[model samples]
Target: MPAVTEPKLIAGNANLSLAKAIARRMSMHRGMSVSLVEARVERFNDQEIFVEVFENVRGEDMYIIQSTSNPANDNLMELLIMTDALRRSSASRITAVIPYFGYARQDRRAKARTPITAKLVANMIAEAGVDRVLTLDLHAAQIQGFFDIPVDNLYASPVFALDIEHQFRGQMNDLMVVSPDVGGVARARELAKRINAPLAIVDKRREKAGEIAGMTVIGDVRGHKCIIVDDICDTAGTLCKAAETLMEAGATEVHSYITHGVLSGPAVERVQNSVMKSLVITDSIEATEKVKAAGNIRIVPTAPMFAQAILNIWGGMSVSSLFETDTLVPIYEGLYQRS
Candidate 1:
C-alpha cells in the first residue's frame, strides 16, 4: 500500500534560528521534508512590509512559524499574507506558530476611547485563512477565547523550570518565585510549584505605557533569592523597579524570568545596570544584537516543546500530556534521542 501523506513544516521571514531549532527538534531534514518557501519580505515606498512566497505549497499541510515581535505590524501582515497565499494555493492545512504574539496586551479596552487591538489582530488572523494557531505565552490567557479556531497555548514555564533545576540542582530551597504584578501571579505560581518554592507578588501601579510607578513588595523577601516572573519585558521599567524594590526589601538576590523579551527603547541599558542579578527570557521573539550583548540577559529555548507539539498533532497523538510533567520521563527520553 502507498504511504500516507506527510506533514510539512514551512517557515516565514521571521526568527530563522528559532524555526531551524524547532525543525531540528522534530528530527526532520531541513527544507527537505517540507516546502518552506523563502518569503522575500520587503518594504514599499509607503513603508509597508511586502512578502512573496518563493515556492509552491499546493495541497500541502503548511505550518508557518513567524513571530509578530519586532516590526510588529509588518511581521503580522507578513503572516497574514503568507496564510492567504497558502490558502490560495489550496494547502491542505495551515497552522500559524507565533511564539510571541505582539499587541496581545491590548486584549481589552482599558480606557474609554482605546481600541482592542489584540482582538482585532485575532480576527485578522482568522480571516486570513489560518486553520489553527500555535503560540506561546500570550500576554493575556483570555485572548484564546477570542479565536474561533483551536489555539494551542504552549508554556515556557516547563522549559524554564527544567533549566532552573539543571542550573540550581542543590540550591532550590533558596529560591522564591515572585510575580512582578498581580496579573503575573499565575505565571509565577506555576513556576514556583515546579521548583517547590514559595511564591511572592509585587504590587505596582502603572502611570503610563512603558512606565511603572510606585512598586510595593507584597510578600517578605528578606534574605531570600527572588526570581521575578513576567510574560513580557518591553522597556524593563516594571522589572527594574520591582528588582529595586526586592533589593530594598532585603532580598538576597533578584533574578527575573520572562517569556517574551520585546526590549524596546533603552531597555538593554536599564536591565544591564538594574539590581537584577540575571534576566532570563525565552527566544519567542528574536533578540536584537544590542539586547543579546547585555551582560545581564539570558536566552532560553522553547523549540523542543513546540516541535513535540507539532509531532503529536501530526501523529494524531495526545498533546494534552504536555501539561502533566510528573509523567514526562518518556517524552524527555524521546527528546534526548531526537536531540
Candidate 2:
C-alpha cells in the first residue's frame, strides 16, 4: 500500500466495464489507438477456431483482462490469441487478468480416464506465451499448481468483509455465515471469522448436473440470521434449496453471497421466487439485464482489489497478505467437535 512504480495496462475483448473500473482505480485512462479485432473467426461450415491479433504490442507489458465465464470456448480462444499476439509483437511480458477462471471445477480426474481440463487450460495459456496469471477465487486452490509460470490467486473476502461491516452496522452479532454446500464450508468459515460470527454448513448432495437435493443442517440455526457463501452461483439450484432448508430449520432471515454471478437458465426466475432474503455477488462476470433488475441480487465491485493486486505484482509486494484470515480453520475445528 506504499508508493511504487506502476505498470501500463492493455485490454482485449473482455469485460470493458470492469477493465475501465480497474483503470480508474489505478488513476489511468483506458489506452487508446490499440484495438482488439475479430480475427477471421468463422464457423467454417464445420466447428473449429481461427484467430489473429491485429495490433502491434511491441515492448509493452500487456495485461489481457478476459473472463472465461459463459461461452467458454470463445473467451478462452480470445485470451490465447490475444496473448499470442502480444508475444509475437515482442511485448516484454504478458499477464492474463482472468477474473473468473472457467472449467476450474474439473481440476482433477474425478472418474477413471477423465481429463484434468483445468491443467489443460493452464497448459494452453502457458503455450500462448503468457508470462504469468492473475485470477480470482479459483474453484480449487490446487489449480495454482497447474501453471508453470507465476500465478496469483486473489481473494474477494476482504472486500466482502468491509461491505458487511458497512451494510449491517450494530447488528453484526445476530449474523451467521452459512455455506450452501459441504465444499464451501471453509470459505464461509473464513468470512464468519473475519466478521467474528458463528458458522453453519448445508450438507447438500448433487443428485445430477443442475439438480441439487438433500439439505442437512450441521449446526444450530434456530432464530439466527443466515448468509450463505459460495464461489459461484450458476443455476441458483443449490443456493435456493439451501436457503429454503435454512428457513425450514428456523433461521431468522436468509441471504446469500457468491463470487461469480453466472445466472443462467431459469436462474433469474429461480432467485426471484426463492426464500432467500437477498443475494450478493462480485462483478467478475458482467451481469445480464435480468440479473441487473432482479430485485434480490446486488453486485459488489472488484476493480480496486484487482488494481491493488496489479500494483502488488508490478511492484514486487506480497499478495498473500490480502486474505488476512486464519479464522476459517479454527471455526471449522469448533463446528466439527464431537457432540
Candidate 3:
C-alpha cells in the first residue's frame, strides 16, 4: 500500500483565529499529523497584494482557509492571490475554504442593470486556479451552481440544533422556531424539525435595502419561546423587527441563532435594544469588539465542524453525514443514556 500524505493547511488574514483553530484540530486528529504551510501575505507600498508560499507543495493537496468578511475586497483578493500562488507551486489540488463567503447575498439580480456579484466572485475563484470550494451556510445555496468547480455548502444547523437541544432539553414543547421572512422559511423549518418545535414565519416586505417596511406573523407564536433562525444578520434591521413582532404576538421570549453575523453598521446597537432574550451566532466570521462586548450576544465556535469537514474531504470520505440534523427525541435519549 502506498503511504498517504497529509494535506497542507494555509491560512489567510481574513480570520486568523479560526484558521488557527482549524489547524489545531487537524493536528489533534488521531493518526493524522498536519501543519499549516508557511506563507507571507503582505502588501506593497503602492497597496498591491503579494503572496509567497515558503513550503514546497509539489503535487500535494492544499486547502486555503479564509473568510471573505469585513474587508471583503482585501480578503477576497488575498484568497485569489493565494490560490494562484499555490497553483504556481504545483499543488495537486487547491481548495478555497471560505467560512464566510462574502458577496453571496448578491446571488441574484434584484433589478435591471444589477449585477449577479456572487456568480462573478465564483468565476474569479475558478479563474484563480482553485480546484474546489468549501464554505458554510451560504446566503443562497444556488451560489454553489455558479462555481464550475466542486463546491461544498456546509450547514450550521447541526451545531445550532445541538445547542438548542442542550438549552431547551426538556422544554422543547415551549419552543417555536421562526423564520424572519418567507425566504428563510426553509432554513427555519429544518431547525424547527430538528428541535421538534413548531414553526412560524414573519411575513415581511422590504421597501428598501437594510430596512423592512412592515412585518406580520404568519403563524401563532403566542406563549411560545420563539427562536428565529436565519443564515445571516447584516444590519440586523430585519431580525430586530421580527423579534419585536413576535413579542407583540405574545411570544414569551424571543431568541435567535444565525449562521453568519455580519453585524455591519448599527447592528450591535440594534441588537442590544431589541426585544430578543439572546442572540447566538456562529464564529464563521470573526467577531468584532462591539459584538464581543454585547451582553445579549453569544458566539459559538464553528471551527470543529469545519475541521471535520476538511479532514473528511482530504481523506476522500463523505461530508454529507456531518450535516445530519438532530431531533429532540434522539437528543433526549442520548442525553439520558449518557447519564
Model 1 quality (TM-score): 0.91
Cα RMSD to native, each candidate?
A: 3.2, 6.9, 2.9
Which residue pairs collide, candidate 3?
Answer: none
For each candidate in turn, the TM-score is 0.91, 0.86, 0.94
* lDDT of candidate model 2 versus the reference: 0.79
TM-score: model 3 vs. ground truth: 0.94
Candidate 3 lDDT (Cα, whole model)? Answer: 0.88
- Which tens-of-lDDT digit does each residue in 1-339 have in candidate 3? 231767789988989889888887777763566667899999999979999888899998899999999899999999999999999888889999999999998999888999999999999999999999999998988898999899998988877888887777788889999998899989999888877889999998879775678999999999999999999999898889999999999999999999999999999999999999899999899898899999999987777777878878888887887777532223223432211
Per-residue accuracy of model 2 over 140-203 as CA lDDT, tens digit each: 9999999999999988776677667667777788899998877887888888988898999989
Number of the predicted model whose lDDT against the real structure is largest: 3
Q: What is the lDDT of residue 172 in candidate 3?
A: 82
Instruction: Indicate the worst ten consecutive residues by lDDT in candidate 1.
Output: 330-339
Which candidate, 2 or 3, has the higher lDDT?
Answer: 3
Clashes of 2: 0
Q: Going through the candidates in order, what is the number of backbone clashes in each?
A: 0, 0, 0
